[model samples]
Target: MTKPIEVRNPRTGKFDYVIIPQSPKLLSQQCHRLRRGQIQWQELGIDGRIEALQQWKQALLSERDQLTEALINDTGRLSTSLLEIDSFFSTLDRWCHLAPQLLQDTAKNTSVPFIALQQTAVPYPLVGVISPWNFPLLLSTIDAIPALLAGCAVIVKPSELTPRFVAPLMTALNTIPHLREVLSFVEGAGQTGANLIECVDLICFTGSVETGRQVAVTAANNFIPAFLELGGKDPAIVLESADIDLATSAILWGSVVNTGQSCLSIERIYVAESIFADFYHQLVAKAHKLQLAYPALENGEIGPIISEKQAAIIRDHLQDAIAKGAVIHCGGKVEELSGGWWCRPTVITEVDHSMKVMTEETFGPIMPVMPFSTVEEAVDLANDSIYGLSAAVFAESAELALEVASQLDAGAISINDAGLTAIMHEGEKNAFKFSGLGGSRMGADGIKRFLRKKAYLIKTNASKDPWWFNEGESSKDI
Candidate 1:
């Protein structure tokens, strides 16, 4: 028997829950069952799949309270948990709405008069999704729902660090027997995730760059497709003509929301030299207003650092930045309050690419701001990192913002606002550099990634043409 893994409550920093990963034999059996069920699941067709998913959504809605509570316990935050639940529901609805149209088969006449083309796609039999702990429910299903809608059976393995939500989610899943046969949630750590890659036809992973690379390699060994959304050191550039108040507010929320524990978080900030002091001052003031959600999860805006390991990274980044002569205007340290690890929204200036906080994936509510004399310099600084997941650009006019955004190396860039990708899913974008690889997990590609396309080339007439072997003439004709 596998030993159970302990889970910590982010709010308390205590290991209060345990999850036992299924045995390798059991996991393989479950994969077999899901693969067998996938035939019927795919046969149900897109419309039928949509109906089953909608029913599952209803079942999940009934278990909403329990699921919400589990998520709150898992992540040690209230409002964000609620938002995660909402986002999961929205994702389900969005995929259900988009799948039918996106999955439709098409027939077209070819340039050759006697030929016609029929295009269609078949779903990958089984898809394995390994999601992160930051937004447990949302990230876990972000790929699963679309894959399910595309007629693929899905098995999700969420982070063992936050596995509490799996029970209620499974309960909801079980209510729809048809869906249950095709969709499952497995609880385990890295080994489980690696094992899952061997059992599925495709794998979708949302996590760190280090782990993502491992998943990619394992999936390659298994000869399966791997779609990864990895780490980010997303940067936000504030132009001189930008509104300091607007830029600061948007950048603050983008950098620190979810305690900056997101792949899309704007960790590095580059501002026009003219507004450098004012920008940092406004950012610090806003950072000070946010409080830790300690004792009570509702006490404040900032939540406890969700992972203890992540908390240590946050502390190390802060220490490195301070040691490197970065000036911390507010919230410089990670504090242990009532056994929970919390850091107030920290705003630092006098920072450069040399500091870990500026270049590394801090994954904390720490923002390092630097000044650039020219727009070109700002763009260069923002593009200096190994990560190019996403970024943002702020300017007085829409045209200027778009122009600046066009020069960035990141996948998704928000103009005038920040973290729009968190809410907006209609745009199709691919991660650049070490951020990630594979197709877009947004827009039409989300569901399409689960499918393999096939084309039927038809001859409109019965007569054999010039392209044939010409049996009668053969060598003599040549």
Candidate 2:
């Protein structure tokens, strides 16, 4: 028997939960069973699959309170935990509505008069998902739901850092026998995640670039596809003509929401030189109003740094920025309050890419603002990163905002707003650069990625093709 893994509570900073990873032999057996069950799952057809999913959704709804409480304890946040649950529900409904239309087979006439073309897709039998800790429940299921809709059996292994939610989630899954046969959640650390890649037909991972690189290599060695959603140092550009109030408000939320523990959060800010002073002043004022949800979860906008390792990274970035002569407008340090790590929406200025806070993925509520003399300079500064997940642009009008947004190197730019991709799933986008890999995990492609396309060419007539050799011709004849 493998020893159980101890889990840390983000709020109280105690090792309060434990999870035992499935033994390798047991994991292999589970994979074999799930693969065998996928045959029946696919045979159920789209309508049947949708029915089974909706049933599971209802089961999940019944366990909502328990799941919510578990997530709050898992992440040390209140409001975002509730939002995560709602997002999960909406994701189920959206995929159920979209899958049938997206997965329908197509038939059409070929260029050759006597031939017809029929196109269909087959789902890979088993899909493995390795999710991160920040938004434990939401990220874990983001790819799984669509894969299930596409008729793929899915196994998800959420991060060990936040495994408390798995118990309640499993309880919900147990109530739906049909879905239970094809879908499951395992609790484990990196080794288990690595083992999962070997057991599945495809893998989807959401985490740091370092780990994502390892997942990709393992998937390649195993001869399977790996869809990776990695880290980012996402940027936001504010124009001279932009509304200082609106821009600061939008950027503040984009930068510090969930205490900035998101890949799409605005870590770097570039403002037009003409309005740089006003922009920073208003941003500092808005950022100062935020509070850490420490003593009570309802006390403020910012939550405790969910991962202890992440808190250290935030601290290092702050120290590096200060040493390099960056000015902290407010909330500069990562503080420990009753053993929980917290940062209250830090806003910094006079920053550049020379500091780690500006160039690297801090993954905290640290916003470092810089000034740009021209549009060219702002665009250049924003594009000067190895990461390009998403970004934001603020201008006087939609047209102006879009103009700047068009030049960003990232996928999914928010015009006149920020982090719209977090709430809106209808628009399809790819994670550019080190942000991610494989097909878009939004819009129609989310489900389509699980399917492999096959084409059927049909001959309408029995006659042999004109290019074929004459039936009775000699081999040497020209």
Candidate 3:
């Protein structure tokens, strides 16, 4: 039996609604339904699929206001909540235009004598996507769109915390003709996600490294491929020649956006000793100016963490830092704003790798600023973490910045920009270490994840092939 998941308003500390968790049996049934519809879904062809996507795009745009409002209510922070909606719509639009070209079969050159060769991207029949609640819509449907465009049926298991937005989004998409059963959703906790991983042909999961490992193990048991886009403790390096204003703004937004609940959030900052004081002052001033308000407020910049459990973790990390000779530059208290799970945006200095705030993934509004004497030391500090999802280097000299970026052990390194810019490309966005596995869910690589490649060779003439020797009697020379 599954329990009801309370959808709490992090802003008001009130249980706004509850979602009845789907049992494993029901989740399995949804998978079966999706599998049954795969053939007909593929028959819809690229154009037909694009047409359906167009309908989805229009539906999402038509209901943008309501969706944004729901997100704000669910998570708080109106501006940050809109980021999810905006990303969803923009991703949908991009896939609709690119899927046809991306999914097309390609001709290949043959090395075996004179045979014509070709290859096709054959999509898996059913793709399972387990999305996190941090950016619910973006992670949930972003991977699913590529699978659907590649003619695969998708079953999305949304995070139990933020299941509210997905149901309405699915309802809107189902309004399109012949899409009700083709696209499906199951809402529940981890068990439901486990069921999904076992049933599908391929699994795409976005969440913590611990849970992602469990998903990977489950997929391994079932002998299916799994794509794990896990956690990150991303870092930012500011050189002596860096633009203080730009680097400060990027670090502030990069670290505190979505209340530091993002996978690409910059949890650590390494600044050169020459300009460390200037950057620290600017960062503290910006952190102090942030408004931590209720979700109901339209202009709120900082909002509450998702749950008391998460808030406690943030508190523990902060406490650990302060106890370990770290100085809190600005905002370090957990304020009960309207009884909400709110924490002040915190900036800490005199930090080292021993503290939890500097080492672990603090998915809250906490930024640790440490100083380095050389660019090499800065790079060393940035690459010292066990997680390497993304990193950034800020400097006026583009050449030196790029050189430093190239040496960092991260999936994507940004020069004088936010670490999250890695997702903007349509290429491989793989995690270097424990951050994730497989390629990114963007561009052709994203579409290809759900596809298995098959090679074809055809003979133009009836003449015997040159290398037609029997396997039992291998020829020494041709």
Clashing pairs in 3: none
lDDT of 1 by residue, 15-101 (tens): 899999988899999999999999999988888888888888888889999999999988888888888888888888888888878
lDDT of 2 by residue, 1-478 (tens): 8889998889899999889999888999999999999999999999999999999889888899999999998999999999999999999999999889999999999999999999999999999999999999999999999999899999999999999888888898888877899999887899999889999999999999999999999999989999999999999999999999999999999999898999989999999999999999999988888888869999987899999999999999999999999999899998898888988888898788899999999999988999999999999999999999999999999999898889999989999999999999988899999999999999988999999999999999999999988878768766
Tell me each candidate's TM-score: 0.98, 0.99, 0.95
Question: On residues 223-244, what C-alpha lDDT tens digit does candidate 3 reach at each position?
Answer: 8899988889999999889999
Q: What ranking emerges by TM-score with the best candidate at the front? A: 2, 1, 3
Residue pairs with backbone atoms closer than 3 Å in model 2 (clashes): none
In terms of lDDT, the poorest run of 10 residues in model 3 is 419-428
lDDT of each: 0.91, 0.93, 0.83
- Over the full model, what C-alpha lDDT does candidate 2 score relative to the true structure? 0.93
Question: By how many angstroms RMSD does model 2 differ from the true structure?
Answer: 0.9
Best-to-worst order by lDDT is: 2, 1, 3
- Which regions of candidate 1 are displaced past 4 Å? 474-478
